[model samples]
Target: MSTADDLKKLRLKAQIGITTVLGLVSIYILLTQPDNSSLQKWAIGTLGIIVGYWLK
Candidate 1:
């Protein structure tokens, strides 16, 4: 594969890995939190995932 193609594949793999981990963390955070303010953490975690994927 060309260098560019390799880079693209690497980026896609990174995005999938990071987003999966972040999603799990978000769920854990939401589930463990007693107060309803966990929504903020969810929102932020989602945004982080989005930005991370987008930047890839």
Candidate 2:
């Protein structure tokens, strides 16, 4: 593959990794913390995933 294709694959992998981490963290927070801020964190995490996909 070309360098450009390699770079695109790397970028996509990074984005997926970040989104997965954020989603896991958000789920952890929601499950462990029964508070108001968990909701906000979850929302932010969801938004991050959306924006990540949008950017991709």
Candidate 3:
């Protein structure tokens, strides 16, 4: 593969990793912080996933 192709693959992987981490963190907050607002977290997490999909 070309250098550009390799870079693109690396960037795609990073994006996926970041989105996954955001989703997991949101879930953790929702489960652990009962007093905190979960709706906001859910919205942020969903947005992250959506953005990632859009990027791909």
C-alpha lDDT values of all predictions? 0.75, 0.75, 0.74
Q: Give the TM-score of candidate 2.
A: 0.64
lDDT of 2 at 55: 80
Q: List, residue by residue over 1-56, the lDDT tens digit for candidate 1.
A: 47998999998899779877777777777767766585756756686867776787
Model 1, residue 48: distance off in Å is: 8.3
lDDT tens per residue, model 3, 1-56: 57998999999899779877777776666667655476656756677776768777
The residue ranges of model 1 lying beyond 4 angstroms of the native Cα positions read 38-56
Task: Tell me the TM-score of each prediction against the true structure.
Answer: 0.62, 0.64, 0.59
lDDT of 2 by residue, 1-56 (tens): 57998999999899779777777776666677756785867766686776777686
Q: Model 1, residue 33: what's the lDDT?
A: 71
Residue 4, model 3, lDDT: 92
Model 2: residues with Cα > 4 Å off, grouped in runs: 38-56
Q: How does model 1 fare in lDDT?
A: 0.75
Give candidate 3 regions above 4 Å deviation: 36-56
TM-score of 3: 0.59
Query: Which of the predicted structures, 1 or 3, would earn the higher lDDT when compared with the native?
Result: 1
